[model samples]
Target: MIYEICVDSVAGVRAAKEAGAHRAELCANLLEGGTTPSLGLIRAARRVTGIGIHVIIRPRGGDFLFDDDEYAIMQTDIAAARQEGADGVVIGLLTAEGDVDAERTRALIALARPLSVTFHRAFDMARDPFAALETLISLGVDRILTSGQEASVLEGLPLISELIKRAGERIIIMPGGGITPRNAGRIVQAAHPKETHFAALTAEPGGMRFRRDHVFMGGELRPPEFDRLVTSGQIIRTVMKNTTG
Candidate 1:
């Protein structure tokens, strides 16, 4: 099985490589479901890890329906990912009507040529899963990361399995979201997918010896100021063992 880990840092990429992951989907602001990472981060990850680095090309978080300005930004980001020597790029776009934006998506795919392209979890938000699958196949997307239009992979296993069967040799259907070591084996056994994506993250205390507890950097829904999430090599290793053994 191909293990693709979603990571947000060069350290995370290194951890994934040491733990035997085949690839890392590099991103930033993962709390908001991942955004395009900085060029420096992409370049550093490429230099530090031998595993494939597929950068997420999202300009911001929220929905996959990007405005024209955001679409232009995505195009620029794809070019930057290529210039930074990234192995692949993950992207997604949708029409207002909830279908794949074939026109814009096709342009992005054309720009990402030679580099592998993965249609990200926006597939979950699509109006019709089967129709979206066919469109992606026709657009020549290399793979699709989805949770079967549900909140998590476990809840979406039935649809994921069917998508894999339908895709056959045309495109790859990669299951992702809420995939932990505890359920990794079960997912593989049931879905029988060729590839899977997940983040084996652990929270670590940030490096701040002194802090003002009363202050908040973000708005109402803010994360803890002194804690940060990082990928755990041990967790990845355990998941790998559970998945294949």
Candidate 2:
């Protein structure tokens, strides 16, 4: 099994590699459910790590729904990521009515051609998961990143299992959200996924402290969002070794 760790910063990507992650999904703002990283950060990550770096192609936060200009931006970003030597790209698109925008999605996939495309968690918001899966498979998507339509994968295990059964090895069903070393073992045993995604980050905002009264500029925690049970390289490798062994 492969583990895809979400890294919002160049530092996080290096830390993920030290933790033995097979791949890193590079993004700018994990707090907004991940967005595309800048060329500088992407190049910095590439220079520092050998792990596969799959960049998120989201232009902004808020919703997976996109307009014409936003789609154009995404296409341009995909080309940039490919040229920058990204191992893969993560993206998704939904209609204003909350359904898969098949034509637009297909076009994006074409732009990301030859580079692996992961239909991000926007898959969870689809009106119909089964039909949507069919559309993605028909569009020749490589994989899907989803929490099985629930707020968390643990809560959505039944649907995840059902999805795995129905998928029948056609496309990858990668479970994400609320997954951790503690629960990852159970999730893997239940869903039998070939891959999983998580952000192993420690809530140590104080260590990078400048001044508590430095409110002149309101700081935002970028990338590798959220606190977790295990944030150390040791914890990540130990859990992965135990689970995949």
Candidate 3:
């Protein structure tokens, strides 16, 4: 089993390597459910870790539908990811009608070239998983990181198993989302996937000693401003053992 750790920081990249992860999907703004990481961060992560770097190519959060400018930005980001020696990238696009934007998606896949592309969790937001899976397979996507169109992988394991069985050798169905050590083994046993993705993140108190009130940098539930989120090597090893054993 390949433990693909989702990371939002360069430190997380190093931690993933230390914990024996097979790959790390790099992104930023986890509070917004992960956007594209900066080119600098991608390069820094490459310098620090030897594991596969799969950068997320999301232009923003909130919706999978992107405008022309957003599509342009995604194209640029994919180029930057390759220029920085990234091993692969993660991307997804959808139509307003809740279907895969195959035209634009195929264009981006063409631009991404030799880098392996995993259709990200936007697969979960699709109106239909089986249809989207077929679309991805036809477009030559390397994998699909999905939670079976549910809130969590465990909640959608049955669908994941079905997708995996149907997928056969056509494409990879990598289960991710709210996967923890306790349930990682269960997911592996049920889904029987070749790969799984999780963050294994922990929060550490910020360095500031001063106190403030009634202030926040985010619009939604945010991690404590004084707490920095990071990947935990212990959690990585724990989940890996549970899944692989």
Candidate 4:
């Protein structure tokens, strides 16, 4: 199976390539799930990694419900990804009622032509996975990254397997979220998906020697201010070997 390593930095993309991954999904702030990485980051990753670089076009974290301006920003990011030499774009838009935003989705897919388009884990948040699958298929979505609408793919294996069976060749169902080396084989065996998404990330101390911990940029539980997340090459290799072995 082909693996798409989720990465937040150009460094992670390089690590993925070194660790035997087929592609890397470039995003920022993986803490908030994943937001659009900076254009500079996109170019840097493209330059450094020969493997495919699929950029996540999310404007921010939180919900998939986007307003008009946010939608416009996503469009701009898609265009930028294309111009900046990304291999594909990952995006998702849901209506207020937790359904696919067909019109908006179609528009983005059209804009991302030639380059691949994956409807991201926003599929997991849909009201009905079956209905969402139909909408994506009708829109010509190339692939879908989902966790089976549960906290993790393991919890949603039944639905994931069913979706893979029902989708047939019409759409690609890629399992993502909380897939570790220990469970990668089981997930692949159960879901039987062509592609899989994972992040072999670990926290390392930040470069700053002198630190101030009084203020927190994110939530209280976030890693100490001096700690940052990075892709673990060893973990990536282990996950890949287990899943594909």
Candidate 5:
């Protein structure tokens, strides 16, 4: 089973490589659901890790619908990914009607040229996943990163299995979202996919930073937070050894 870990920063990408992750989904602002990382980060990741770098080509945080300008930005990002020696590009786009925007996606794919393309999780929000998968395959997408149309993979395993079966040799069905080491094996067994994606971060015991003097109008601290694991190199190595052994 191949493990594709999400990395929101250059440090996270390096950590993922140390942990034995097969690939890193390069993005920024994970809190905003992952936007495109900067060109410098992309180049730095390539120089630092030999593992596959799949750059997320998303322009912003909200909604999958892209304006013409955003679409143009995606095109530039795709070309930049290629110039940076990225292995592949991950992107998602939908029509205003909540369906796959095949025409626009095809345009981006054409610009991607030599790099592989994996349609991102915008698949989960589609009006009809099965139909959308068909469209992605027809567009020659290398893969689809989906959560089976639910909040988590465990909840969507049944549909994911169906998608895998339907996909056959046409395209790859890569499952993501809430995939943990404990359930990774189970999901792989159920979906029988060629790969899987997960962000395995352990709570860092006291990593959240805040100003103690800072308070809201009511004189209460905003909220306490904790540090989360960015998927340590050690964890990745152990998981890989366990899974591949």
Candidate 6:
């Protein structure tokens, strides 16, 4: 089975490669559920990892609907990702009515030619998964990263399996979200998907020698300032072993 690691940094890309992941879905601010990475970050990741790099094209977190300006930003990001040598890009766009933004999605797909494209977890936020699946297939999207419209893949196993069967060879249905080494094997066995996506992250103490407490840089709902989350190669290796063994 092909394994794709959701990573937020160059270090994460390196870790994913070392651990035998088939690809890295590179993003920034994964805590915000992933956003478009900077061009510099994309270039750095390409330099550091030989594995496939699929940069996420989300401008921000929260909803998949985009304003005209935000849509334009996404267009620019897709071009930047391609310029930076990314092997692929992940994107999602939805209409106010909660359907796939087919027109805009088609435009971006055309622009991202020669590079594989994955419709990110925004598929989970779609109002109708089956309709969206058909729309994406019509647009020629390569794959979709979804959790079956649920909070986790395990909870959405039944739908995931159905989606895979319905998709046939028209598109790839990749299960992602809340997957761990413990449950990876079970999800694989149940869904029988061709690929899986997840992040193997761990909190590591930041390189701060001084003490600075109570000053929230990210404003209240924030992670610890003295600690950072990073992908762990060992964790990825363990998950791979458990998944494919």
> What are the Cα lDDT values of the candidates?
0.95, 0.84, 0.92, 0.93, 0.85, 0.93
* Candidate 5 Cα outliers beyond 4 Å, as residue runs: 205-229, 237-245
Q: Judged by lDDT relative to the true structure, which candidate is superior, 1 or 3?
A: 1
> Stretches of candidate 6 above 4 Å error?
none
lDDT of 5 by residue, 1-245 (tens): 77898887677788887777789999986767799999999998898756889999999999999998998899999999999999999999999888999999999989997888999899999999989999999999999999999999999999999999999999999999987667766777677788888776654555445545444333243223443446566666655554554
Query: How many residue pairs clash (N, CA or C atoms closer than 3 angstroms) in each of the candidate models, in the order given?
Result: 0, 0, 1, 0, 6, 0
lDDT of 1 at 41: 92
| lDDT per residue as tens, model 6, 115-169 | 9999999999899999999999999999999998999999999999999999999
RMSD of each: 0.7, 3.2, 1.1, 1.2, 3.3, 0.8
TM-scores of the models, in the order given: 0.99, 0.90, 0.97, 0.97, 0.89, 0.98
Cα-lDDT of candidate 2 = 0.84
User: What are the per-residue Cα lDDT tens digits for candidate 4 across 126-152?
Assistant: 999999999999999999999999999
Task: Give the range of the ten consecutive residues with the poorest summed lDDT in model 4.
Answer: 215-224
Over 4 Å off, model 4: 219-221
Q: What does the lDDT come to for candidate 3?
A: 0.92
- In lDDT terms, how accurate is model 4? 0.93
Name the runs in model 1 displaced over 4 angstroms: none
Q: Compare the candidates by lDDT and give the number of the best one.
A: 1
Per-residue C-alpha lDDT of model 1 across residues 37-88, encoded as one tens digit per residue: 9988998999975799999999999999999899999999999999889999
Residue-by-residue lDDT tens digits, candidate 2, 80-189: 99998998999989987778889988888888888998999999999999998999999988889999999999998898888878888799999889887788888888
lDDT of 6: 0.93
